[model samples]
Target chain A: MKQVWVFAEHQAGQWTSVTGELLVAARNIADQLNGELNVIVCGDQVEELAATLKQWKVDRVYLSQHPELNFYHPLVYTETIVDLVSEYGCPEMILFGATYLGRDLAPAIAARLGTGCAADCCDLKLDENGNLLQIVPGLGGTIFATIVTPFHRPQVATVKPGMLETLGSSENEDKAKALKPVEVVKVEPRFPQNTAAIQLHSVKQKPAKESGLQAAKRIVAGGAGISGPEGWSLLEELADVLGAAVGATRPAVDEGWASHDLMIGQSGKTVRPELYLGIGISGDMMHTIGIKGKGTLIAINQDPKAAIFKQVDYGIVADYRSILPVLIEEVKRREG
Target chain B: MQPLQIAICVKPVPDPKESTQLQINPTTKTLVRKGIPLVINPMDRNALEAGVKLKEANGGKVTVFSMSPPEGELTMLETLALGADEAILLSDLIFAGGDTLATARVLAAGIKAQGNWDLVICGAESFDGGTAQVGAQLAVLLGTPWITRVSHLKRVDDKHLLVTVEDEVEQRELLVQLPVVLTVESVVNQARPLSLWGIVEARNKKITVYNADTLKLDQKGIGLDGSPTQTRDLFAPDASREAEILTGDSPQQIANQLLDKIGWSRKGAAN
Candidate 1:
């Protein structure tokens, strides 16, 4: 039987969440294909990570220790992974998180091995023949196309966080398999830095708010119907009360009510959060696509027929002007 | 003194929101070539903006290099309408489904086929895959220096150019010498709207399309087979998470309930 590999990604000092997500994915793929799961941790102070992974079904853990590997040098990391995987010969597949480090590291190694890489994939599965099948978005999440590296060995993919279910959804026992521990120790490497000198400077601008859109656990999205800057202020107040992010629709930006960067639609960032609240926003399908990723969506719109209603778990019909500020005050009062 | 000649790369992509269909060859299940209406890549619009701006500022000629089917002609003409001086399309049967690397190869070849260029500016990453590696990979293929995620161009001259990159840490304005490839992100400069007169000119002028044999590309480097990466499978994310709604007699009560869920015990702590 073959094995599957997950590259444990750590940068500076933190073990990225994608590391566990990728490992869970690898474990899943291994289970489906009747293969063993092996995780290769390359960096110092990764001993605890090895044991932690065992709790989640990692059969064998490979720990590579080196001081220089502490900080990422792409060339060094890529070469080390390639060497390790090559020695293992034929792992059914490998997984990496689509973080900056994984994105930088995966392709170079895939190229060296002359294998096909499906980068930034959000999903993966095994075909009837146990070949790795990958699901990656095309045209910027417009279409999810299926691809296969039927001829290649160890099909590799990098996936974003919050997309995959690393652990079993309903499997509560946390049952897993642990095999013999394997470790790799390589010399610290000094590779070339593309830019001549790395420069550092601080911005005089005030620090970012407690919750930016990317960091927010909850988000309240408004649409063009909100009409003016006052609506934004109202939304901000509500967000402050609940500690949520504020998002806008395209029409809001087109009308000069908010910055385009904060717009939620096909053209903007994909946000996934615990709670998504919409106020005065007509649910155009474009805007609706961005909200389904949330835990539960509570949409408020005067237009009962707004497209967003179809996707949300709950809906409210009213003019946002009357509801938002009062809701904020009530929330604040309750907290107080 | 003439400003350096430039060729900008662009492609046609489908809008993500629109339902798109591929023309499939009944026999092989491969995408058929005909009847796919094309639009300029959402990101390449930014590349065209940078190209036109460079031409206008430096008094240089802007030529667009495109790789697509014969329909790619429309994309080039659109770029011309956006103020490009000329446009060329590389339409080779062998150039289909070429991933970033292979796509970069044929594009680099297309530019090389045009003789010499002082600078090549492309959209840092296309919207389709958002790889952003094509610009850097193209630079490697051309054996030139590449600066990516460029948000601003400070100055441009014969010997060198300066641009600001949005590095992970901070704003880095680097003075990279000429004989380099620069990728412009959408944030860099907004592509201008096409004007009536420019549209008329673009419609009237013809675009040149070069096939595989015309470019003399290695057969191994132009199509799906030529690509090092493959599109495995794609499906939407499971947007499912457990949500606990707060129930309270009043708005204030609801707010308090939410604060409790967020693990903040102190009332008024958030404000």
Candidate 2:
């Protein structure tokens, strides 16, 4: 039988949410191909985490535990996975979450294995020949491109978080309760190598106010319409009341009104929040692509025909300057 | 310390502000390259700036190379005007439709033709391509170590450098050895604008253009033919959406109505 593998990403103490999503995605593909679904979890003292992975529909979990693997060292992690593939049989498909590590690691693994990898893919399908079809947005989400890697084995793709939904555990629970028993096989891990050249000297977390935009549950974003610091201050007041993170359009960042880290567009961070409030953004293709599949997009722009209005769930075609202060007051009153 | 040999990769993309003018050719599976003005990708300017600063501090030469149409020579010249000592343009009709992997292979070949280099720099990703794959692919093809999302760098010695990389969660400072590739983040540095003296100096700088045969590039390893990934279809995404536009004469009335539409109440606002 063919095999589908997912790189179960975890950092610090918790498993990233994308891991669960990938497992759900992998299960569907594995069933379609009548293949075994497996996972590779690499970390020090992560056997307990590996055990948790076994609770799912996975056929096997490769737990790579080494002192050097305590943290995510790019070279060591890539070498470990490559060694694992060489030892065991190579899978027909590999998927990763399009996180910072995934973005940095996917291409290297693809190059090392002499295969093709589609990065930040939004959709995946199988061709008649069983090859993977990677659907991506190009030209900053202006167009959609369906890409295929027909010649390469173990077709690889890194999917952005929130693009795929995690299959509920209730179904897995039922399967575990009935039918054939599933015992998740745990395989040995490869030894970590090549740790001398790159040294991790220090890691500094950003202040709470400025960090975690991608992982935030709520966001208030501004665009070119937000003229200057005063406009940002208005957005900040609203954000403070709503307890939402702040993001910006490319032009806002270019104009020096906000930092690059807060920029949300094709060139900036891709955000998927429960509530995305775009105060002044016009919903250009570049900005829209980053938040394409987000949950609820509420746009406030003066132009009734702003492109963003077409993609939003609720649009308020009024001047943000006029609407913002009132909205801030309303939110404050509600919170009180 | 030995003079550093830095090679920066740049791509000329249509000005993002005028992106509405771009069109995808259905038959060719490529952008309709006409009339739209092109500029050096915004992040590539940051990478070039990083390269130039390293050269300025460590005493060496910074060479830049770009793979685009012949019109891209102007972009390469602009890169020279920014601060690079030499510029190379890889352009040919045959190299027009290559994807990121094929482009990386061509760049790897071009970098090899330029002799030994201590370091290579590139932007994290391009706005048009939006694929942060080239630097990694290029490093793998060139058989060198690489680090992406690098925000800061300092030369520690002839053989080593200090780099601060922004990972997903935290910022890490790393000590990377020579002969490594670094893909810089947008926040790496503020790109320096062109100066009168710099533009004057660039007038005398050499801007070389190389084709397939000149770089000794294998025909099978470049352009659409060499690319492993193929774009089967390209089309505009559906923009039609069902959005309810709220209306009210006053800001307070509009705010109340908007709150009602989004299923939010005064009590529910408590986060």
Index of the highest-TM-score prediction: 2
**Residue A159 lDDT, candidate 2, scale 0-100:** 87
Candidate 2 ranges beyond 4 A from true positions: A167-195, A203-220, A238-247, A253-277, A289-297, A325-336, B238-240, B248-253, B260-271
DockQ, prediction 1: 0.22
Provide i-RMS per model in Å. 6.9, 3.4
- What's the residue-level lDDT of B235 in candidate 2? 63
The candidate maximizing DockQ is 2
* Per-prediction TM-score: 0.72, 0.89
Enumerate the chain B TM-scores of all models. 0.81, 0.91
Q: What tens digits encode model 2's per-residue C-alpha lDDT throughout A125-171?
A: 78787888888877555677888888877787898776666666677
What's the CA error at residue B109 for candidate 2, in Å? 0.6
Worst 10 residues of 1 chain B by lDDT: B237-246
Residues B75-121, model 2: lDDT tens digits: 98899999999999988888978877789988998899989898999
- Please provide, for model 1 over B73-161, each residue's C-alpha lDDT reduced to its tens digit, 9 standing for 90 to 100: 76778888888888889887778878776777898888898888888888866645576556656665675656666777745446666
